[model samples]
Structures are given as C-alpha cells and as structure tokens.
Target: MCGVGGIFFKSAEHGAKTGEIAYRILDGIYRRGPDSTGVALWHDNADGLLYVGVNCEAPGGGGRILEALDQLGTVKQATDGDGYIRAAIAYGGSEEDLVDAIDALDPAITVSSVGRHLEVLKHMGGVANLDAKFDLKSYDGRLAMGLTRYATESRIDFTNGQPLSARAVPGLAVMHNGHITNYHHLRSSYALKGYNFSTQNDSEVIPIMLIDEMSKGATFEDALNITVDKLDGCFTYIAVTDDCFAVVKDAYAAKPTVVAENDEFVALSSDPQSLREGVLSDIEVWEPGAGEVHVWQM
Candidate 1:
C-alpha cells in the first residue's frame, strides 16, 4: 500500500501553513509507505517564469545543470540540495521543449517538474529524512500534494517517486495510491501517439492521460470523470493545477481515502487519521463515493 495526502489553502496568504500541514499529513501515514516520499507545491507566479526541479547524481552535476540552464534562457535563481537542484528560469519558449532540452543533458539528470507555479521535491526514504534534507516544512505555496510510496512495481529510486508531472502539460502534477492493472496497455497507446513516459511506474500514466484528455478539449473535471471509465484499476488519485485541486477514484475505490474541509482549506489523505493529525478543529470529514470527483479552486 501507498499513502497520499493533499491540502489546498483557500487563501493565498497561507503559504507557510501549507508546508507545515503537509509535513504533519505525511508524518501521520509514513508507516503505510516508508519507501520514498515526494511533495509537489503550486503557488502564484504572475510573471510566467518556470520553476524547474531536477535530480542529478553525477559528479559535477550541479555545474553541468546550471550550464545547461544558461544555454536555454535566463536563469533567475538556482539552489542546490542533496542530489537535487531547483532553478527558476525566464524562458519564453514552450514548457515541453524546455523539459526536453534539459533531459538531454545527461542520463543521470532528469527534469522532475517544470511549471510556472509548481515545485516538486522528492527523496528515496521516509518523510522525516526527506524533511531533514530539504527542510520541507519551510516550503511555501498555495496548494500541495505529497506521497509516501511502497514501491510495489517500480524500482525504489528518487526518480520513480510520486507527485509526477506531465511533460507536455505545464502546471499539472499527480499523486496516487493503488495499482493500475492496465498500465501497460495504456502506456502502449500513449506511446503510439508520441507521448513520452519517464518512468515505468504506473502512477506516471495518470498525469499523462489527463494531459491527453485536456489537449482534446476536456475540462479537468471532465477528464477525471472520463478516467474513471477508461482506467481499469482500483486506484484513487489527486491532481493539481495552478488554481485547482482535484481528487478522483476508480469505479471500485479499493484504496482508502478521506477528506476534511472547512472554509479555510480542504485536506485529503489515504486514511482519516492523517486528516486528524494534520488539520485543526472545525472541519467536516467524509469519504468520497466510488468513482467520485471533487474539485476545489484556490
């Protein structure tokens, strides 16, 4: 089993609180999935600058990454961490092309996420260890989603972690629990259409599928509803964009999920205990029905 948690702040000013609560939620469910931890956050970026998070393990990787970024556009800021680097770039080109250019630098370097308002950080360990390395509680954003993975099918590594983003679609990321039984079929179909997948994990398909549907004129909510019918799996997932946070489940709803909401914020977790541990009082809690789709906007 895996654990997933998402919190959305109704007010944009609660950036600090966003990081604190995300830590609590992950801490509550770390036992369910101690293999790896990942978090993705979305905030306000009015200037349309892309925040790119990448993982590089090669020697002198940080310098190489920065040099690559310089070739692409103006590097506004770059910060290095353990096995990871986040760069803010002012590029007036396509997000997809930017990601592709960075990905070609070295096989050891892959763009974890790239969006105007998104930042993703992940590690191959528990939540506390991840926090110790990156000080995750200090991360500030408007909405956030995190995952503790059990590594059922994919290799246990930093790149295979959850909170995976779509290469073709900016400002979209997904975290999920439970397995996709027909993942190979779906992967083949998308590959035939020239969609590239970075990892072999099943969770990666959710964001790509959503991007495909949205490219075909489907709304985010409508794309999720269509996914319930198209994906033959017993999974539940949370997808987020710059201004929206959404939760969806398959027809079976085999994986556990609970949600708590109030006027200030909405929180979801793989189990109710996480909400209790993460959220304060005065929130209404309930379980979403099978195949339900709920969305909240920031």
Candidate 2:
C-alpha cells in the first residue's frame, strides 16, 4: 500500500504554504510507505508550466539531463542528486521534442504529465531526504500532490515510483493504491496502438488509457468512467488536471480512499490521517462507494 495526499488552492498566488502542507500531510502517513517519497506541484501561468521530479544515478547524469533540456529550449531551474534531477520545462513543445531531449541524455528517463497545468516530481528516498535535496520545504504553488511509496510490484527506483503522468497530455497525472490484475492484457492492447509503456507495473497503464480516451474528445470525467469500467481488479485512483480532480474506485472498492472538500479545496487519501494533516482537519470524511466517480473543480 501507498499514501497519496493533495490540496488544490483557489488561486496560484494564494500563499497557501503548499510545501509545508504537503510535508506535514505526507509525513503523517510516512509509516504507510517509508520506502520513497515524491511530490508534484502545479501553478497557473500564461506560458503553461509543470515541475517534474527526477532521479539521477551517474556522476554527471543530472547535468546531462539539464544539458539536453537546454537544447530543447529554455528551462526555469533544475535540482540534481545521486540518481535524479527535477526540472521545469516550458509547455507548448511537441511530444517529440521532450521525448528526444530526455532520450538523448537518458532513454531510461521518463517525463510525466506533459500538460499545461500539471508538473510531476518523484523519486526513491525518504521524506526528509527528498525535501532537503529538492528544496520542497520552500516550494510554493497553486496545486500540489505528494506520495510516499512502499514499492509493491515495481522496483524501488525513479521509473517505478508514484505520480505517473501522461507525457503527450499535459495537466494529467495519476496516483494509485491497489493492483491492476489486467495490466498485462491492457499493455498488449495499447502496444498494438503504438503506445509505449515505460514500466512493467500495472499503474503505468492508467495514463495511457485515460489519455487515449481524452484524445478522442472525452472529458476527464467521461474518460475516467470508461477506464474504471474496464479495470478488472480492486483499486482506487486519483487523477488531477489543470481544472479538475477526480477519484475512481473499481467495482469491488476493496482499496481505501477518503474524500473531503470545501469551497477552498478538495482532498483525498488512502487514510483519514493524511487528509486531516494536509487539507482539512474538521471536514466530514467518508469513503467513496464502489464503482463511484467523485469529481470536483479546482
């Protein structure tokens, strides 16, 4: 099992202290997933922007990822570490541009949620290490979500970490709890459609499925409903977009998910304690029904 928590602010400049909020919330759930921690912060900008978490392994690996980014275009800032680098890239670039840039330096690297309003950053480490290395303690943004992983199906590396994104579709990111038993079959089907999967883990298949539906003109809600209907196992998933947030539970609802909201924000997590610390402390909390779709506006 993993811990996922997030808060959506009404404005990009709301002075919400997102980093501290995320830290407290995630720290509260540290015991649920002590293996690694990841966070994705989103804010509104005229240019459209996203910040992703990166893990670097080679001596100059972080620099190499930055160098490649320079060739692609202007990058705001980048943070590097033993095996990861988190950076911000300008939106509006073609999918090929980003894929080629990251591939040129490290084909093993993955860029998540390449959308106008979503940027993801995640890696393998504890909350304190991630905060210190990435300066998450001071990060301020409009919308942010964080995950601490326990590494169930996938290896404990950046590639198999939480907060997976849809590279071709900006402003779309996903965090999940529970397993997808039908992953292999779904992967095969998507492979035939020219969609490449980066990890063998079933969670990686989610973004591809949602992205495909969204591309066909389905709204985020529509896409999610259709996707959840097809899923064959116990699972609860939270997906975020620039303007919307949704939580989907399988027919069995075997996994846990708590949702609470107010006029200011909407929050969800695998447990109530994280939500208590992260977003609202006194709001009524409830478990979503099986085969339910909970949607809210940002």
Best by lDDT: 1
lDDT of each: 0.83, 0.73
State model 2's lDDT: 0.73
**Please, what is the TM-score per model?**
0.94, 0.91
Instruction: List runs of model 1 lying over 4 Å from the truth.
Output: 57-60
lDDT string, candidate 1, 31-132, tens digits: 889998888888577777788888776656878888888788989888776677778888888877877887888897888888878778787778887787
| lDDT of each residue in 59-87, candidate 2, tens digit only | 56777777777677667867775566766
What lDDT would candidate 1 get against the real structure?
0.83
**Can you give the lDDT of residue 119 in candidate 2?**
63
Q: What's the true lDDT of residue 31 in model 2? A: 84
Root mean square deviation (Cα) for candidate 2: 2.2
